[model samples]
Structures are given as C-alpha cells and as structure tokens.
Target: MGVGGNFWDLLKPYGHKEGFDFLRNKRVAVDLSFWIVQHENAIKTHVRKPHLRLTFFRTINLFSKFGAFPVFVVDGKPSPLKSQARTARYFRSSGIELASLPVPEEGASAERNSLFSTYVQECVELVQLLGMPVLKARGEAEALCAQLNSEGHVDACLTADSDAFLFGAKCIIKCFCPNSKEPFECYNMSDIEAGLGLKRRHLIAISLLVGNDHDMNGVRGIGLDTALHFVKAFSEDDILNRLCEIGKGNASQFQINIKSEDNIEMDGNSPHKKQLHCSFCGHPGSKRDHMKFSCGYCAKKDDDEGCLRKPEDFKCDCFSCGMNRRQKEQKRLENWHTKICQKIAEEPNFPKDEIIDMYLCNDNGYFSANDGPHTVWGKPNIEMLIDFLNFHQHWDPSYIRRMMFPMMSTIFLRDMASTPAESLLFGQYEFDSLERVKMRYGYQFYVVKWKRAGGNIAFKVPSKESGTQDVAVELDETVNLLDDCDVPEIHQDDECSFLLTDENMDLVGAAFPAEVKRFWQEQELKDLKKRKNSASKSQENESPASSSARSIQLNITEFYTSTKVKHQPKQEESSKNNDSGDSNMKRNESSSSNLPKSVRRRLLFD
Candidate 1:
C-alpha cells in the first residue's frame, strides 16, 4: 500500500548495512499495528489465540535478550483520510453489504471485524505481560513511531511502511529477521538523501505523484523516474501548483504530453489521441484483450514470440494481469504476516525487574536484632533465576548463573557473610587497626559468627530499650552509632567485617560470648608471655662468665650419663636371660598362641 512499483529501486543505493545485532543496547519504537497487520494471515489461519500471542511474545523476548528496549505503539483509531479504505476492506472481508456497515462509535457488527479487534486486544495484553510498554497512538502507529524517533525517545522506528519516511523518521528498519543467520534490512534518512540526492519534501512529492494509500490514483503515466524528475526540478509548493494547474486544465492532455515527452506512444485511434499507453511498456489496449494477451512491457527486445513469454510477464489490459497482481500481493502479505508471527512466537519474555528485585533490594540498610524477616539476599533469587531458565529453556544452570549474576549490583550482598570474607581473601582487606575501639553513643556492635546459620558472620547491635528493655532505637542514636563505627574500608567490605575487625576491640570484648572473647584474650596473653620469657633470657645472657661456667658443667654431666647408659644396656639384658629362661618364655608364647585369635592378638598387642 506504499509507493508501489519498485519505489525501493531509487533508494537501493541507500540501503543500510544489514544485521539487527547493531541494535543491541538500543531503544526502538515499534509500530504494533504494522506487526498485527503483518501477522493477520497467521491469526486468520490459526484456530486458537496462542498463535497470535506467541508472535508478540517471541519478538519482544528476542529484543530483550539483545538489549533492545522496545516501546510498542498501537493505533488508536482509523484516520479520517484512511476511513474509506478501512470501510471498504472491512465490508469486503466480512461479506457484509456496504449499506450495512456499522458506525464507528457503535463498534464492529461484522464477525471478522470483531475477531480482528479481539486479536488486537490479545496482542496488546501479550506485549504488556512481556513488560514492554504499550502506547495507544492518537492516529497511526507509524506516525507515532516516527514521532518517537524524531523526539529521540527511541533510536529507530521499525516498520515496513514507506510512509514512515515521509513522517520524518531518521532511521527506519524495513525488515527484522530474528534469526542471527538472516540480517535485518534497515534504511537511514541520511543515506537516502546522500544516495538519491533528494530531501524529505522531495520524497513526499514523489510519493504524492506516484500514488500512495492517501492518493490512490496519482497522475497516471507518471512513474518513479518521472516523479523523481518532476520533484527535483520544482519546489514542493511549485509542484503542488503545477498539479493544481493541470487539474484545472485538461488532465488527460497533460498526462499525454508528459508521456509523449518520455517517448511513450499515445493511442492513435482514440479521439484527440490524449489517452496514454501502459506505463510499464508503451502499449495501447482495449477491453477485447483476453487473459493470454502478451505485454510488450515484459517482452525481450529481440524476441518476436510474445505468447510464449513468462506467465508473470503477461501483463496486458487483460483479466490475467489483474488476477496475477492480486495473487502476488496477497502472497507477499501472507509471507510478511507469517514472518512476524514466527518472530513473536520464538522470542522469550524474561521477567527482568522481578528477577532483579528478588535478588537485590535498592535500600540495603541493616535491620536491628528485633527486626522482622532477615534478608537472605541474593542466594534464593539467583537460584530461582537458574531454576526458571532450566525449566523453561532447558539451559545449563551454570551458564545462566555465569551470564546473569555478575550483572546484579554488589550492594545487595551487604547482609551476606561471604561478602566480607571474599573481600579479605581477595586482598581487599580494609579494616582499621585494633587500638581505635571506644564506647560511642552508648551502643556498640560485636562481630560474631553465627554457628547455627552455617557460620555466617554478622554484626550484633543492641536495639532501643522498650518498657521490657527492648524497643526500637531512635534514628539519631542509630546514626551516631553508625558514624562512630563507620570505617570506610570495612563498610565497603560489609558491616559484619567492620564490626569483627581489630578496630572494634572494646565492642567485641563486651558483646561476644565468653568463649569467643576468651579465645582472643588467651592469644594476647600467650604473645605477652613469649615476649616476657624472651626478655628474661636476654637478661640471663648478659652475664657471659656465669653462662660459660654453666655450659661447661652441663657438658660434663651429659658425657657421664651417655657413657653409663651405653655400657650397661648391652651386658645387662644378656646376663638376665639364661637358656632356660629363654626356653620358658618360648613355651609360654606357644601356649598363648593356642588361645582364640582375638584373645591372643589382644594379649600381644594391648
């Protein structure tokens, strides 16, 4: 329904580099009506509604994964200018009489119209559920898309409508291929101007002359090349002036003059010879031409045999050409519809926000000991995401985790014990040295490891004193406590690490259990004892003469004990064991071996 008959040929040199991957991390505004219309064939053919929903769902899903945030713009109502076409189509499709057409306000009375409306509603719902915002345009969806692109709300407008160019979209994607193997077909306004040597107004003028949805019958015999020539030569206002001048004068004569100038022959037999030949090829025809009549337009220059031409080339003023064009257009429309439906059905709708909130919260402030619901933080949500991916796509959970987890904000891990350990283990340790501990704001925190919770480290801070000695702490007091305890590096690691480190010894000593506190105290005592013993030895070593004499006396005693033990051991054992004693011992061992193996082994080994 756009500027037909190879309108793209003039702008082919301006075609954009293909591929949708470039759209990653970009925001695009989609013409939802275009999509629905493009998928109309699928909707009509399918028995259930899921086929339609699947189309939208899959398309949005691909966009999301590719990091393209799409804003779907749906048509609100048919424009007044396009009302005739809409009414005709409605009546034609529904098999309803034109006289029986319902008024706009009364809603569609035809079954086909009602079904189409329902499908549109379902599409909107599907997109909404997929988390893409849906906007109802006051006029056409393409117009809205163009506006959004112009306003910089989106990077581009995705539509097949050539009218989108007239609507002032800077960038338009003519076709989207969801598969990575097939690239998208895009067009840039800049490229168009550069390649075609025409501006926006000139393009609009050409559309007006060539015929479009708004103007069904443009100046006949004025094709793309002729339209381009006329537009380029005259200003937009001057072109309109010329059209008006021609309209007031002999329109047929003007068309013939234009056609003759382009070397197109007029019908010689006709009155005034004003009627022109076929625009595709210069052939004058009458109503008598049959379906098999050959077109000189589609014929080869050297070939005189016209009847044997390709079936598609038989474009005479015959019933066959009319039927051929209709069939081709219908087929093209159906193919386009099927492509959009498949794209929508294959893409996924991942719950990005819900998944993020499940894993991480914005305000990660710690709750007091008496506070309800301890945040388990990222673990459960990460697991949930993994499980969801596994169940839905049968993807490896590890791969999903690898791809997803690093994208989450680290602040959510504030309550987790591993947050600190990871920081310290990775040489990012940031705790103040021990001597800084002091009682500030009459509240302190001790870093304690919770054994029951798989040894998770956390900060233990006292709550506000209620009548029963437990109440919510005042905000000011809590602020002061945080300020006094606030160690920059420690906080960066986690609150737990900040409290547990050496800087908060006074709090640790008071708040930790006796065993935990005693363990630190014992280590300190041992260190002190070692230092004192070393000092005592240094003092003793200060008297060199006394140390030397003690060393000599010790050497003499060691020599005497070594000689006596060496001489006594060899003869003493031999004298004590006579032959008879040896025989008696052997007999006793033999008798013991006769006992049960267990008793014998126990007696021998134990």
Candidate 2:
C-alpha cells in the first residue's frame, strides 16, 4: 500500500543475511503511525493507526540488547480541517473511532477513547525505556524530525513510509528487526526524486493533490503521475482553483467517466479523449468550473450538454442513513477548533510567534489563519515562562505540573473541571498516568525552543538532562552528612570515600521512592540469601518457563472485508503448542490502487 512496495521489495533479497543484526544497534526513530498498526486493541481500518500492537518492553529490550537507540515520536492532533477530512474518511471506510460521541451510553465504541489512551501510554513507556527523546509536534514527528535533519540536528530519519520523503528528509532507512536477515534499505531524497520523476518539494504537492490516505482521500481520478503533472503545470492558486472547479462539475456523468478512465491509464496518455461530464453530478462538465458539480443538471444545460445525452440521476446509496452526518461532524470540529484558538488568544502569556511558527504553511496544506493582534505586551513572555520553571535540566514532575497548570488554563479555559494537573488527574485518576499525556503533549522544553526559533537557533539540548536533574538534586540534599563527611560510625574503612562524590549514584538513590528503596534492600538481601538456599528450589526457579518475559494475550477482533478475524486461540494446553496456524496469520495486503497512476502503473507492471 506504500511507496509502490519499492521499500519492502528492496529488503527482500537481504533477508536472512548476516550483519542484519546491526539494525538493532542502529538508532531508529519509530513514528506514531507504525506503532498504531502494530497495536492489537484497535479494529483494523482503511486508515491504519500505527500505534497498536507494539510492546513497550519488547521494543526497549530489542534496542538495549543490540546497543541501538530508539526515539519514538507521537503525532500531534492535526489541524481542524485535516482532522475533519480524517473523520470523514473513517466514516466512509467504517474502520475508525469517528462513531463515538462525546458522551457514549454503552458498548466498545464508548470504550475507544479509553483504549486509545491506554495504547498511547504503552507506546510512551517503550520510548521512555530507550532513554531516547520523544517529540510531540503538531503534525507528524517524522516530518518534524525531517525538518530537524534539514537544520543538521541528526544524521538521518528512520521510518517505514515514503511520506517521510514528502517532508524533505534527505535520507530514509527502513527499520526491521535486527535479528531478521533482511538488509536495511537506505533511500536518498535525490535518488527517490530521480526514480519517481519528481523533486522533493513536488512530492509534498503531489501528496496533497492526490490526497494522503492517512489524512484524507486523494481526488478519485488523480494518480501519482497526474499529481506530479499537476504540481509541475499548476501553481498553488491553480491547484485550489482546479479543486473548486472539479467539485463544481462532480455530477456530470462524462466527467465522472473521464476521471474513472483516468484512474485506469496512469501513463499520462488516454486512448479516448477526456470526457467533459462531472463525476459527482452526472451532467455536462465545464472547463470554467473545472467540472465541479453544484447542481446535478446545471452544467448539463451549458453547450457541453448539447453533445451528450442527459445522464440518469440516482440517489446516493448511503444518503438516507448518512444524512447530515458530514455537516454535523464538521460543525462539531469547527466548534472545537474555534474554542482552542480562542483559548490560545486569551492566554496571558501566549507566545503567538512560537505557536504560529510551530506550523509551516505550504500550498499542499493550509494552517489555521491567525487572528487577534499580531503584537501583545509580555503577552505570555516565553522567556519568562521558561525561567519561572527552569528548563535547563531534564523536565521533571514539578516542571510538568507547573507547565500544565498554565497550559491547561490557557487552552481549556472554563471547560476544564480543574487545573491542568488536577483536570489531568481527574481524566486519568492517577499521578503515574500523567506520563503518557506528558509524552504526547509535554513540551520537551528543548523541542519547544527549537520550534520557536524556526531554524534560526542552533544547539541540541539533551532532553535527559532536563528529565533527571531535579531527582539528582533532591538525592544530594537528602544524603546524611556530618561536617561534610559521613559520621565515623557509618564511615567504615570499607566504605569508599568516592561514594560521597558520586553524583550519578546519589541521583539514582534520590529517584528511588521509599517503597522502591525497601524493595531494593530486600532484593539485595535475597541475593545474599540465594547462595544458602537449597539447590533443588533454585533449579526450579531457574527453569526456562519461569523467565520474566511479559506474555500478553491479545484478543484481536479484526473487522475486515465485512467479517471479523480473531488471532490464534489461547488454551492452557496451547501454552506448549507451537503450531503456527496459517488461518490466524491474516496480513492482508492492502490494495495500493489509490496511489498515483504512474506509481500504480509501475506496481501493475512490476
């Protein structure tokens, strides 16, 4: 379904080869989309959420064992317009959580929000374990990372999708299990452009014109080649104008036929002349209107209609059941966006330029238009906010707490039941639960500053420092001392003098809460006692089955092709069963027909 399978296809020959284990040792920044797809909780849909199925511990262990590093980046909520487009796509495909209401009465649909939140936590923990930085940018983090690379922040971006190409990444290396024999494929931007016959910038434009399956459905008739032609031939204004015109002629049968035919021949030429009917209206098309259908028969009355017979009009198959669904959804999102924008406006210390700079506008996508005064006094002095809670070190609980209070107050306003920390507590019902929300929304004090500078600033601030400093400080403050030295009774000859200055050990001690300390002490005693225990009992404990590998029973109720699919059954006896059931292995190859025609043609021919 992606990159004409050129990416996966390239790795096939190298699978089972030596040196592939190097992948585990390499630093790979996993994108949010990949995580969504691996999740077992969510039902499969046309637009896959890659956050599912990924085990936080397994990923961490994989990276740790191989001496590799991984940075997991979560995609932020998209623009209101983009989100609306996403919701509509889910509605059409019947595979997303768009059906859930703000207040649900009952069923799994209602549980989707909880499930989604839980899965995000799992993803965050996996990323956290690797000690790699995670970013929560407004758009896709892979794209943001690409932006970072352009500014020379990192060596390269590691992801699975070709869409990263659209974000201007100079290089993209496909990620695979280090244990797998597959050779990691590395694609350069210039090579990709040459192979695809489109420049890197044009890739974004083509993606926009053809539609991104993750965000929105591309125009039905536009394929890769046509989309490429579109970016080359038309300016941004021309593309928008074409969209408006095509929408107007949607009803004409001739136009729909032409588009349908265009979908078939992706090599840039058609055997038959392009039809002038609107696909949506089933009426005559107009070059002036770009064949968009407003009224089913309006375009037909024009001169173009004289050459063709009147097309029969049929009611939309799902119209009655779906009446006003689009409008209702649109209204809901518009209200949400307006409220958010207003809240941003009202924040006493809002940094307009920073927030504005967070998003980059291109012809491919339009960001929310800015309103309110472009200038405001100390209106949320970003620097003051930075200092009020020091960001020089790794972000700690208190820092998150303080930041949340102001951020929630500014964004949620009266809608929130309490302070950001309190409301989040209310939302999650626990303090530990704050990690995922923070991972997703927490402004890595560093990433935030980098974004604010819009590439004008340089210097990569280590996020780990911001995260660990307070714990280190607290530990240092709590250590017992007498005149800057340990008491004589406690300071035995064996007690190393170096322990007093070991900042890292002190920091670790500080990070351990009371119960944790007791548990560690007990574990140490257990180790001392282990040598005296009976050999038989130790043997029992050392059995392979007793290893502490977390086993998860994922009951995947997948809905596909109008049917439900469940994974291999789990029975007590099945614990020893190694039968790899073919029936349970349902990796449906998603059709890539929606991609650009040239790409499609390449796939079809390949």
User: What TM-score fits each model?
Assistant: 0.40, 0.34
Largest lDDT belongs to which candidate?
1
> Candidate 1 has what TM-score?
0.40
- Cα RMSD, each candidate: 24.3, 32.2
Cα lDDT, all candidates: 0.49, 0.39
Q: In candidate 2, what are the lDDT values of residues 221-315, reduced to their tens digit?
A: 44565455445544433433343343444212222111111233122122334345444444345534543334444435564443333357543
Candidate 2 achieves a global lDDT of 0.39
Instruction: List, residue by residue over 208-279, the lDDT tens digit for candidate 1.
Output: 566555444445556787667655555544544444444444223432122223243334333322234344
What would you estimate as the lDDT of candidate 1? 0.49
Q: Which RMSD does model 2 reach against the true structure? A: 32.2
Residue 208 local lDDT, model 2: 48
In terms of lDDT, the poorest run of 10 residues in model 2 is 444-453
